[model samples]
Target: MRRLLVLLLALLVATPAAAQVRTGIDVLQQNGFAQLRAVAARHGGKLKLAVLANPISVNREGRRTIDVLRTEGQAAVPGMAVVKLFSGEHGINALTDDMDIDDKVDAASGLAITSLYGRTDAEKRPSAAQLAGLDAVVIDLQDAGVRYWTFQTLTKYFLQACAANGVEVIILDRPNPLGGLAVQGPVSTPGREDYTNAHSEPMRPGMTMGELATMFNAEDRIGAKLTVVRTTGWKRADWYDQTGLLWINPSPNLRSITQATAYAGTALLEGTNVNIKGPGEAPFLRFGAPWIKGTELAAYLNARGIAGVRFLPVTYVPANDKLYPFAGQRVQGVEVLLLDRDRIDAPALGVEAVAALWKLYGATFQIEKVDRLLRNRAVLDQIKAGVDPKRIAAGWQADLNRFKARRARYLLY
Candidate 1:
């Protein structure tokens, strides 16, 4: 009897947890809870459902969808329940750094909100007990279709943890604000991996966070049972406005579509000496390093006639803040005008702007340092070597093609 008991214990220990559960966007949009309710009913055990943190707008508009699931879980699933809510960098109650957000909890929902960023950023899995009564976990976060955003990082960590704990994760995907096609930029190198940039890719690969996640799993072989609930009728090239979907501020800094459009390339300026503060405007568009000869750089860019854009030179002083102590410091730079909105390529534009400056003022220009900011040396190196911008842009075509081919298999839309 002792020998038999020992063998039984070994067998139990070796047994694997159940395969991960999976769901798609269709289920989320149409009737996700029905499936969860059914799973809980069948398990006849406690079921825990968690709504991961998201950008303010996603949480606000998508709250109704989440509430529906919560309501259904309580009403139908026996021994099933919804517990704590998790948020990322901005926190669950919409608290943000510098930008003030009202972190008020819902009086009716009574869901205890917690900050994943506060407690831990890279860690996404709750305790096994947290999943004790739960059969699976569901994720519904919005993405802005660019690299360097934290929402996708939050998702990746969750998937990794769930896999380790034998928990399944469902990703309710949304449209890529930029579109599905056109993978720009070089793949991220191994050493460059960090929180803001989970992958080592060149600036602006023109991929949605969902697509990036799928690519990351495949390349890294995460081995998690992942499924993306993609947006319907979304073409690879269509921008967000074309979809006519609701618009909500993904982050405080990203106030309007124009800002989002400009951010892809200009945001890189933040990593540099550039200020990105608007020229004495309430939501200043973007300010660059005070040292940059804004007027000269603007003229060079204007001469290039890079399709669909214009730069304006003006002096800027931050309002109510000493961020730039050189307030009233006269700087020459232009307001960017999208001559052809459809033709603007953010990453390319950024590189060209940098290149133009380097060309005009070789010694005065700083190229090598900014290369790190771009996350790859190729874009800057090519320009320094006097490679034509058009040709340099062409060199990336093959890599982009390969990425597109591999990316096709994972296209949920």
Candidate 2:
């Protein structure tokens, strides 16, 4: 009987996170959802847990982790406490979905974080007192797979905190919304390694949070005991749209998988005067500024013929009364539409747009601050020298290839 049990256990361990929509959510995969379920079943008797979760951390079956843990009674990490989240400008409500244009602390989640960052009453980092006795922390938040998105930044900080407190971290892996195939732009430099570019990785690391966690643990030598509950069945080339999972907006601006794809580049403009989140609900999918001549700019960009995307003259006012940037100000800029989603090279597109606009508007284009996001100051330098955006993009191919080779070891999907 002992031998039979051991053999059965081996089989169970070998099962993948194979996901299926056996329910409303897609957590039914062999190496994906099943792996998490098995963890609960194995730890059914284990105790003391905290989940660092935002709104989108749910299984493919559409059940949130906290809900599942709650429903699992004592078996699934008994007495698990929910840690509140801190996303700088986005309210706790922006962490989840809602129809309200008010970007206040409105997108409510039942599991709230006491030390949340967005709330005035919340603390900065959870005090050691808050995490004293927790055995492990499960991080299951969704990421856009782009470097600028705050989810990974929050995770890195959380890991550092957990390591300091000697708590283990288990990452319930999710697909990098942009897929795990493309690495764009430059690896972050030392001074630039803050919330925006926390790692020395490229603009789009082409990695899932679990995969990134592995890289983070090794490269940074963070000394945290990290276990990644990895994904199966996902391929490097597959985007979130192909994941067979429902897309949840990790933030108020990133509403769809489409926007997530375009975000790697467009979001680089966050530091600039240009409003990347524009005219309508699809932020980053289109951008405009009041001073931009949309028609002229569109013609310039369309002439470049960057693969898989088209540009159009557009005018928009940041419409959300609460979260809106250029509130009540109408801006004229280009609307980016993807003719072939597969062919869209976001980083390249972003660089080209910036270069063209810089040539036209000079200082008015606001390209100087890109180094904050991409980390390689050389990019801005080259732009200042009138280098072609294509050449600038080509400059990084060698670096991206080296990064890809290095990251291949940590990939789980």
Candidate 3:
């Protein structure tokens, strides 16, 4: 009996505990959505709400936030109703490949889906008519924790529109998959603000959606009635995988945590002529072009001795002819293999990768287009001029320090 007891204790000690990180939706559901109800109560006990969500917006049990708000939320919170659904960069389904999303009706929820993403900048936010009847807009989208990701921009736009109108905004925060530590890369230069570079933050701002909304509200002086239902049991240092949540691809190409980590660097390639969308199940984890010499490129990247990552030669014919460059033709490139997530400076790795490609394939490499996502013309110029990538990265330190200090004032976690 003593020996059996000792074995049981040992087994228990070896096993890890279940993840305790509870997202904002989980907390809201736990509290029967009192926060939402209070907002509705202020506006004559009738809430006409709109939700900006994607497939990733789910509760702990994987119930979609829209469904919960429509069913449980209505039941729990008197006079609260979800009137409309808003889609960000990707459509509500999150499967749309096209940048310009059209307004449609959600098949499952039977709600009118408004596409916040469109060809023109004016179409990206809710119009005065759309905001007229709405009491509050609930934002519950997952973010990639990088500045270039368009969802954060959509959130900022939503907040601006809501503030302009009288509607309140409630942010049901989720984890910044990359974690809340490690601010990296250059801050967006003034007057370089586009849809992709919405805020002046680093390439990887390392902030959650709720925190970003807070910063945007104050810094931009929008002064919207903003409420952030923050996640519980989440540490600033804990990555999304550490949160024990289901790994839903925030975007189609960003399939896994590893891929998302690689995306911070590899995604910069997309703006250039290089194809980061892969030869494998994972996109952004690898990049290639028909002109690339796989072994030579890999050798060059490996020679740089960039910390926390390595490169491997790969050759593949992209499956989709329409979507990827050199679709049917064979393409060779290097796959970025992350060795240490914590130690890797993804933005720096991106700089090095672009520099390598420029040196090897300068004639064909469209290095100028890289600034679209990189948001730094000086760095792009430096890469073109053959400046050491590490040295170029080091130059951004002062700017990063200033941004870090500004960012510190807005961090919730």
Candidate 4:
């Protein structure tokens, strides 16, 4: 009997950690919902938790995450407190089709919703009145891992405010979707510390939002009492497909992974007169302006033979954010194909586009656009002065390398 008991204990100890499961909101529901209940039980069993969210069109599933938390949170705390909804961009309970528009109180959640998207970088800190009576602030948002995505900036703002208000921030993290193997773009320089370009680089230092939160509190010095419940079964090499988490559109325009992949590079075009919108379909990755010559640009990009990508000539006509009318014109452009995403250098792609645009359209192309997107004036100045795009791309490698080493320290997974 003693030997049999010892054998049973050994079998239990030998079993692995449940194959490191990935259950999207289920994992967080287990942690966030149950942990709050546990904490409430300990702290005189009454806690008021404030939930903060980013208003993006792609994440209807987030509504479920919020709903589960609210229900569980109310059960844990009872009548003395209820979960309050605070929206950053779009209101709670709104459809993914809504843009940055805010709606009234969420009818389903029945919680007062507020917007933080209107707050400026200069006034990013949440008002003292907003922080009052909150036991803790819980943040659970999905990120696309692009600097221009804006969700990260909102996270930064909330962190800063929470640190100031003596509020504990619990960040329920998700995957980067783009994976964490490489930080593939321009490094945002010192003077360019605006909200649209918040990170020290245009591309992150190969870190997830949780890692970013740790870095912000540690190296970046936001000084918030931040804790991150990281995802399991995720690694530096695992992109969205590996996690088995459904793609929830964080915004209206971003529909597919291809669109998100193209965004890091093509988003630079936003600073130009290019139209990012399209007709009859979501204009995430499927559209461009008519000003560009597709065939010519395709040939140039092909000759450049950009690593990990192939460009095909295509035409797109968008009705909005364009200088020209939506005439039945065939715009010339290329559909970007990432043959090897690991080797993709997004900032270099931006440089290649700018250089190619300059060659084809000459003075018609806006040279300063890439600079604004990169948040580095030097890149624009170099490309405009007839510097080699490839060589100019090499210039950023040193900075990226240093940032990568620093970023590796904060990684939790």
Worst 10 residues of 4 by lDDT: 54-63
Alpha carbon deviation, residue 158, candidate 1 (Å):
1.3
Model 4 backbone overlap count: 8
For candidate 2, give the lDDT: 0.68
Better of 2 and 3 by lDDT: 3
If scored against the real structure, what TM-score would every candidate get?
0.78, 0.82, 0.95, 0.84
Off by over 4 Å in 4: 1-25, 31-34, 37-45, 54-63, 76-82, 90-100, 119-125, 279-287, 320-330
Compared with the true structure, what per-residue lDDT tens digits does model 1 show for residues 114-180? 4566434324335555444445566766566566666766777777667677665656666667665
lDDT of 4 by residue, 19-115 (tens): 2334334565555466565545544667677777654312224446566666664664453254566765434432333334453576766777665
Listed per model in order, the count of residue pairs whose N, CA or C atoms clash below 3 Å is 21, 26, 0, 8
| CA shift of 252, model 2, Å | 0.6
TM-score winner between 1 and 3, please give it.
3
Give lDDT tens digits, candidate 3, residues 1-413.
99999999999999866459989999999998989888988998889899999999999899999999999999988898999999987688787667778889988889999888888888886899888789999999998989999998898888888999999999999989999999999788878888998888899998999999998899889999999999998888888888989998776688889998988887888856677884344688888898999999999999999999999999877766466676677789988999999999999998899999999999999988888899888888889999999999999999999999999999998
Please give the lDDT score for candidate 4: 0.66
**How large an RMSD does model 1 have?**
15.8
**Segments of candidate 2 deviating more than 4 angstroms:** 1-46, 76-92, 95-112, 115-124, 320-325
Candidate 1, residue 40: how far the Cα is off, in Å:
3.8
* CA lDDT of each prediction against the hidden true structure: 0.60, 0.68, 0.88, 0.66
How far is 9's C-alpha from truth in model 3 (Å)? Answer: 7.5
* lDDT (10s digit) by residue, model 2, range 140-174: 77777887776677677767778899777777777
